[model samples]
Target: MHIVITGANRGIGKTLAGRYRAQGHDVTGTARDGSAEVVLDVTDTGHHADMAAQLGDQPVDLLICNAGVYLDKAERIDGYPAEMWAQTFAANVTGVFLTVQSLLPNLRASQGKIAILSSQMASHTRAPGGSYIYRASKAAALNLGRNLAADLRGDGIAVGIYHPGWVQTDMGGAAAAITVDEAADGLVDRFAALSLDTSGCFETYEGQPHDY
Candidate 1:
């Protein structure tokens, strides 16, 4: 499959890129800087245009919106700054939208799938009160993916939102549950299982149904 992943310089995104490539799938991985085959800073609309130009009508089978930020890791109520909220939303929410929007034509041509890497924190049932920005951003992403699924179903494009399982990555830290490869592998399987019938699903890395 011809796949595109964002924020692939390290962590789960990086691992997924390598695994997919090793399995003989064509993978275009992007980073904020010029560090991959596609130097796509997801929030940058110009970069999205550049990426589309680079692909130049190449059909994409799968697009993984994996680029995100967790800036409000442990912010107090008064400590949550305004700029922090803006930056976090830009990377986590708007970035996903831009990538998907820029690649719509290619996805439509291929009848493809989109996998949004959201978090368990995105769920309203799991609100623990900390990391307000990250939680809110992820929730917005989940909402975005669901609505996109509804709108794009007629175009034969499927969209799914997933929690990558609190992986042991730079963002997840050392004490997290799973390794990047494990999470990536599970997510790859999840992506493969995505379809028009199951579009807008919110699932875990292991394929379990998640409450939204």
Candidate 2:
């Protein structure tokens, strides 16, 4: 698979990139730091379109909208500044939407899959308070995934929204349970097994589908 992955400098995204590349798949990994295998920013909408053009028709088979930020360093929901919510959404929802939209043509051409990196926190049925910014952004991302599934159905592109569990990464923190490697592997396995009938469902890191 020729895949485009965002947030590839660290955590699950980085680990997934390594795994796919090791399997001899062509991978384009993007991060804020240019040190990524391919330097790209999901937040930069213009750059997304440019990269799609530059790819020159060698369309990516999978588009992983994985770039996001957590405002753990800031105040919690009850007393947090409203600006943080905007900033979080800018990077999470808005950035994700732009990245997916920009690469949509390629995905259509390949009859590919779009996997959105959402979180368990986004599940409304299981919602709680706190981490307001993260929760809201992820919720929007989940909805976006649903919308994309509907919009891309004609192109035979499947959309998946998955929660990678609480992996021990920069965002997930050091005390989290799973490792990036384990989460990435499971997600890849789950993704490979999904079909259009299963698109737009919520899935766990271990490949278990979660009902929304």
Candidate 3:
């Protein structure tokens, strides 16, 4: 399978890229710093265009929209700045949409599946008052994935939104519950299980359905 993973320089994206490559799949790992096969800053339209052009006619069997930001983490109620919200939304919500749009042709050629790494924090039921920007952006991403699933089903494309668990990554912190390998392993299985019949599902890395 030809897989495309954004934000692959580090964290879960990096681990997922390595795992897929170790499995002998063709993996295009993209990073903003050009540390991977492709250079992409998810919020940049030019980068998205360049990435699409570089792939040409190659079919992308899987597109993982793993790039995101959590700018307002732990911000006090009055500390949430407007710019933080803008940046967070740009990366977490608009970026996912742009990546999917840019790769639509390639995905269509392969009848691919899209896996969006959202978070349990995106669920309304999980709201705990912190990281408002991150939570809102992820929720928007979930909504985007669901609608994309509906629109792309006719093209044999499936979309699934996932909560990758509390992973031990730069974003998730070392104290987080799961190791990168555990999260990646479970996510790989979840990605493989995604199909038109189960498209638009919001699920955990462990393959359990999550509340919307």
lDDT head-to-head 2 vs 3, winner? 3
Q: What is the lDDT of residue 185 in candidate 2?
A: 86
Question: Per-residue lDDT for 62-146 in model 3, tens only?
Answer: 9999998887767998899989999999999999999999999999999999999999999999987888888999999999999
Give the TM-score of each candidate.
Answer: 0.98, 0.94, 0.99
lDDT of 1 by residue, 101-199 (tens): 999999999999999999999999998788999999999999999999999999999999999999999899999999998999999999999999999
Clashes of 2: 0
Window of ten residues with lowest summed lDDT in model 1: 32-41
Clashing pairs in 2: none
Q: What is candidate 2's lDDT per residue for 1-212, written digit by digit as tens?
A: 89999988888888998998999999988887887866676777667777777776777799888999988445653666888777889899999888877787788788999899999988887665677778888989999999989888888999999999889998888899998888998999877876799888789978887766
Give the residue spans of candidate 2 off by over 4 A: 72-74
Worst 10 residues of 3 by lDDT: 69-78
Off by over 4 Å in 1: none
lDDT for model 3 = 0.94
Better of 1 and 2 by TM-score: 1
**Candidate 1 pairs with clashing backbones:** none
